[model samples]
Structure formats: structure tokens, C-alpha cells
Target chain A: MEMDSGERFIVPPVNVRETADQIIVEAEMPGIDKNRLEIMLKEKDLFILGRRAKEEPSMGDPVWQEIPHYDFRRVFALGDHVNRSSIHASFDNGVLTLRIAKAEEAKPKKIEVAFA
Target chain B: MQLIRRNRNTTPDLGGLERLQRELSDFFDWTTSAYPTPFRTFGLLEGAWSPALDLYEDKDSLRVVVELPGLKKDEFEATVHGDTLVIQGERKSESEQKKENFYRVERIYGQFHRAVTLPTPVDASKVKASYKDGVLEVILPKKEETKPKQIPVTIQSE
Candidate 1:
């Protein structure tokens, strides 16, 4: 989803790992509501978009600011051999986890060696 | 090496100095190690990590917000001592994959301890804290005596 004009965005930190048959991507996006998050797969790219609900006016004026009050956006290039159709995602505790399975061609194959 | 891309120029950006510092750090991090230890694990070795904090003040209260993604409600502790608010917690790694299995690891883990002094005196008994969506918020109500009071000026006619 596209943010409104003049909206700011922060790049959420991510951790990517590969297993024998699948790849895992975890993005940390604190303060974002589940309904405001979107994950899209286009061609060979995986996109994650999220926006935190605007702070309440009663939250008061900022005395010390460290965390950015901006939307979250990050993209990762999916490997060519990943199974885009079989990708799965889950959100919990403000973390978005995506699991993309590797296609058969990408999995390791053991060849039989025979005496000839 | 450029598998990950961040959004730039499409939206309002951070201050130039902050952006430059972040870019420089990212560059050094990408170039320093053969494996590019993103999270470093050095904070874990040092026994403590400090989470980012934001403090806000209004007429009635001081609000403290902490960024602590992936932590369960039970994983952290928050307390107020005198005029200081202290938050201490540990965020364990979610995946137990081997070191080499990671293509990139930028998420921080291990223990974290953060403390911030409240600007004005607060009523300790009315303080409240809650955790939601990986963010921790603590609200401390200002002391009744310290709250601004308007005294009516009386005119004495001679």
C-alpha cells in the first residue's frame, strides 16, 4: 500500500536465513497494526509495507526522541528458484515472518554412482 | 550484495546528518567482515543492549515509549525509582539456525537495559505501564503540587 503524500518511512531491520528447503525473512516493525501491514510478491522481489497508527495528540510533546514515528518499508530480492506460490507469512508481536519454500530444482539432489 | 533495498526519496527523510551517519555505518558494516556480522553479537558479549527510547512530557504526565520488538509481555520488566524509569529485558533469538545459515542477521538479541530520568517529579503511586505490539509505554502522572496552578490576581481599590 502506498503512503500518503509527505508521509515518512523507516526501514525496518530484517533477518534472512536459509534452510534445507526454504528461506525465512523476519522484519521487525514495532507499533504497526496487523491491519496496516501488506506483503506483496512481484516477479522476483518480496515487498513488506507497514504503517504505525499516528500517535494520539494526548501523548504530548517530545522531550527525547529516538525511535522514528514513520511507516515501515523494506524489499528483498527473492532467489530465482524460490517457490513464489508456496510462500507463507505470519505476523505476531509486531514481527512479520515470511517463509518461502525452495523449488525442486533448488533442492539438493544425490546422484547414484554405479560401477561401470 | 544488494539483495536488500530501502526506500529513499519517495517520502520525507531523516535529517541529513543522521542519514549520512546511518549510511556510513551501513557501509562500514557491509565492508568490515567477511560474513558481514550485522547484529555483531557484541552486545550479547557485553551483557547488555540498550533499546531506543522516546520520552514525552505534557501538563499532567510524562510518557516513556520504548522500542522493543519481538519481546513477549513476560520477557521484560519496567520500574520507577525516585524520578527515574528503568526498563530491563532480554530478547532471545527466535530461530536457532546455525551461524552459516543466515544470509543476513540485522536483528538484535540478548539482554537489554535502559533507564531514563523523568523531567518533572511524578506521583509514583499512579504510574502505569503496558506493552503492546512490541512497544512498551509507561505513563507517570505528575505530582499534584508540581502541576501548574493559576492564582487569581485580586485588585485592591484605594
Candidate 2:
């Protein structure tokens, strides 16, 4: 389905990887300002909103143009094992890196054998 | 009249208008401008880099702010040709000592050019450009004719 401009939501491309202790989500959001970006987590869902500004040209006169002004937002559903309270996000340059550490119960535990 | 009436969500007939608006918005957001064959193909292959633009219009001029991360002031060039503003720049990836274990890479690199057309004529002579913290701001003073004029009011007893 085509996405409407006023839809206020987008599915940003994301890469999710699970390590021993945390699940990392690297989202590509080039051109977005760190200050203008908003990150939120509620329950098992994460939301991101940001705007990507366009460059203007310094010409004596503008007779024609093409670019348009717009913003983007995305929401993702996190797995049950994710620790919502421990989730951390940071924006560097334009990429948004999210780290969600898994709950203690979610990690595999090594059980020792009892010698009788 | 029919199309307008059909679009009224308040009324059952407004469904068409709602649909049209949704369609138009989708079209605007996803569609790319019609460029020459080479440019059009390049845009398709390299992904459309529309980069969100914010234009704030004031009494004297219009200010445009563009987010351009990883862009250096010297690496990019901006110029106004007629009513169009063109920004061309190259984003080079940082040097890597070894090409080992390189998997998926999606970041855009190489020369990129974006052009924006002003809705109203601007006084190009008063244009100013500044770059800070990876954001590029351009100020374009509107032409005298395009600036909103405040009509003088003569007090008269009615």
C-alpha cells in the first residue's frame, strides 16, 4: 500500500542483531538532526521521529526548483525478551543506534551437573 | 463538484476526496522529479535523496534549512541558476586499512546533486548561505513584488 504524507508513520529500514547480552538495532536515518530526533519506547514498541532538512542554493535568482519539505517517523515492535527499562538510544551524525539489553531470564543459563 | 462532494468524509460521498488526498500525498512523497535520462537513471539506482527541506517565510526573506550530515563546507557547492537552487556534493567514506570482513554497506557515497525550485521569485543578490554542525542554511530575500504588502488604512467614519 502507498504511504500517505500525512500518515505520520514510516517503517525505517533497520538491522537487528542479538549478542550475548543485548539486542542492537541500527537504523539508517541520514540527514536527520540529532536535536530534532525523538525516540520513545512504550512496552514492547519503539518509536522514532525525525526530520531531514534540504540544502538551499545561493543564486542571484531562483527561476525553478524541485525539492519539497517533509519529515519521517517509524515504529517498531520489540520482542518480549527485550528489557524496556534498559533500552538506550543515541544519534551520531545521522544514524540512530539502539541497544536493548535482554532480560536476565531471556539469556541462556549454564546448569552445573551435581556429583552424587 | 462531484469529486469534491465524493471526498467529504463527513458525508459518505467524501470518501473519494479522502482517497484522492491520500493518493496525492503518497504520490508527492514517493515520486521523483522528471530529470534527463542520465540523471533519472542515476536517481533510481542510487535511491532518491530528496533530503527533507524546511522553508520558513518571513516578511523580508525565506530561510531554508537542510540536514546534510557528513558534508563539509568545501566539499559541496551551491549555486542558484534562474529559479532553481542546486546543491552538489560528494560523501567519501573514511579510509579503511583493510577490506576484511566487510559485509553489507548501505551508506550513500559519491557525487550527489539536488535541486530545489522556489515557489516565489527571490532576490538572489541578497542570498546568504551558512553551514554549521552538518546543517546548511540558506537565506533568500524575496523580490519586492513577491513580498506581502501591507495596505495603508485611512480612518473614515462609517
Best by DockQ: 1
**Candidate 2 lDDT score at position A19:** 68
lDDT of 2 by residue, A1-116 (tens): 12243543333445456666777765656556687788877555577777654553343332322233345566667777878889788876556778889889997788999999
Tens digits of per-residue lDDT, candidate 1, B1-158, equal 21111212111234556645655777686556322223332222232456778899999999998888888877899888887787887777655435438775667666667778778899989999988777889999999999999999999999
Candidate 2 docking DockQ? 0.10
Put down candidate 2 lDDT per residue, B15-112, tens digits, no spaces. Answer: 55564674465456445522100112112222344444555666677666665655666788778776776776766643243332322233344556
Which candidate leads in lDDT? 1
lDDT minimum window of 10 residues, candidate 2 chain A: A60-69
Poorly placed runs, candidate 2 (over 4 Å): A1-7, A10-38, A50-72, A79-85, A92-95, A101-116, B1-48, B52-59, B67-75, B81-84, B92-110, B117-126, B130-135, B142-158
| lDDT for each candidate structure | 0.74, 0.58
lDDT score, residue B38, model 2? 10
